[model samples]
Target: MTLANGGDNIGIYTPSFAIRSAHEIIVIAVVFVVMTALWCFVAHAIVNHPKLGSPIRRCGHRVTPFVLVGLGVLILYQAGSFGLLLGRSGF
Candidate 1:
């Protein structure tokens, strides 16, 4: 079996793989949980802030579409699709 990183498998699959990876999995899980909790807390605080919340609520609808479009363009550029499109168009 090929490893997730694309390395050649060095030995037969065994319980040792799970044992060796358990700690890494646990650490990743803990970090995910902590980050999610922190994000929730920060978002709640921001939404409840007197000075900041109203402006965000008012502008969020107007700004979100542009932000999402920008993010999509960024992703396409990173994936080289923008270059492909430009090349096809003789840019």
Candidate 2:
């Protein structure tokens, strides 16, 4: 997921920059790696802590599936609309 987001950020933001060079790309990659590592460590610590972990875990279990289902439904709706549009256009 982080990789996908990084790729998307690169795709969406890189073109507007004045200089698109190896140095810039390397810097972006390094920053992305560091930030991802930092966040992973933070999340790990939070999830493993004795005080807060249990409630967070329980909430995650309850909420994650519904969030995923919502995303799935949204994707399906968009795809269905696109398909309908294409068909109407005789594509």
Candidate 3:
């Protein structure tokens, strides 16, 4: 996104920066969704299955509550973002 025209005098940003920002937002969303789904699957596997008796499964069972809370935090973050976009506190 190099919009600098030889650095003679003018200062202007490139148009592609906006597109880059949009791409970053989409990537972040996809990453969050994938991570949340993974966490839930691991949590459910540890909680409900009798065959998954490994140390990692024990850890996942213990960590499932916090994973759920982390999901709540993620949702709160999205709510705050929507509030910022609307220029008001989310009711």
Candidate 4:
């Protein structure tokens, strides 16, 4: 996922900078590693944190895992829309 978006963004703007292929590969590798680390952190937080589950039961429909998931979806939607703008603007 990061690769598709990152590669498109990089390929668009890096042409003027004349960046090398190796550098582009390095950037993608770093992005992949960072994204992996973040995934691990979020997964661990949701799985190991008992408080996260407590809110769902204690608060009924007002508080549930879907709320947290929705927040993540919102964030991703913003990122994707921003990326689309960048892609179209070629910046």
Candidate 5:
């Protein structure tokens, strides 16, 4: 059975939207990758800097993994949303 709101069984439908042209998928992927990398870089800097703001470094270390996981989830959700838009539009 399928769970509510999760859409675990949903297939790739193509009858609603077109988030962008086929080329847009590549752009979307690149954007997501770059954003994720940028976030990681900043987070790394925060966790690695010296003296000031360094006390939270440990906390940053503790939360960085979770933060990365959350970012990953967000990226995945965006990807799904994009696909949904394309699928909805019957593209």
Candidate 6:
């Protein structure tokens, strides 16, 4: 967004940038909740229904475990990294 505003600097926080970041965080949270719900639905479908939708069935059969682990790792990484950044940001 700063790029759209013609600001080339990185890591320089303006009020607008902070507002945009807040909005982005909200969006990320909503997406995370939706994805988690979908994952649960797909998992339930795969387990309870033998003839589930093919794409979701394939994903649940093959990718669900790995995706779960990856989600955990990603959450940890993002938390730690953003914490470090906030700590350094003089807040």
lDDT per residue (tens digit) for residues 1-91 in model 3 = 1134445212111221233577776786688689978988986777566766576655756886797567555554554644655787652
Q: Tell me the lDDT of model 1 at 42.
A: 96
Looking at candidate 4, what is the lDDT of residue 36?
A: 91
Summing lDDT over every window of 10 consecutive residues in candidate 2, give the lowest-scoring window.
Answer: 10-19
lDDT of 6 by residue, 1-91 (tens): 2246444233233332454567786886688689978988976777677566666655755876697567555554544544555675332
Badly placed stretches (over 4 Å) of model 5 are 1-21, 61-91
Q: After TM-score superposition, what is the CA distance of residue 41 in candidate 3 from its true location, in Å?
A: 0.4
**Model 4 misplacement above 4 A:** 1-20, 51-91
For model 2, residues 1-75, the per-residue Cα lDDT tens digits are 744657644443444333357887788778879998998899899999999999988898888779766765554
Please give, for residues 1-91, the per-residue lDDT of candidate 1 as tens digits.
1245342222222322443477866785687689978988997899789999999888889997797567656555544555556786221
Candidate 1 has its poorest 10 consecutive residues by lDDT at 7-16
Encode model 4's per-residue lDDT on 1-91: one tens digit a residue. Answer: 4347665445443442343477866886788799899987986777567878566455656655587556555544543544555675322
Question: Could you give candidate 5's per-residue lDDT for residues 30-67 as a string of tens digits?
Answer: 88689978987986887677864578854657876797
Best by lDDT: 2
Predict model 2's lDDT versus the native: 0.65
lDDT rank order: 2, 1, 4, 6, 3, 5
The TM-score obtained by model 4 is: 0.31
Candidate 3: residue 90 Cα off by (Å)? 26
Error of 5 at 56 (Å): 3.4
True-structure RMSD, every candidate: 13.2, 8.9, 15.7, 8.6, 9.5, 13.0
What is the descending TM-score order?
Answer: 1, 2, 6, 5, 3, 4
Deviation in Å, model 4, residue 41 alpha carbon: 1.4
Report the number of the highest-TM-score candidate: 1
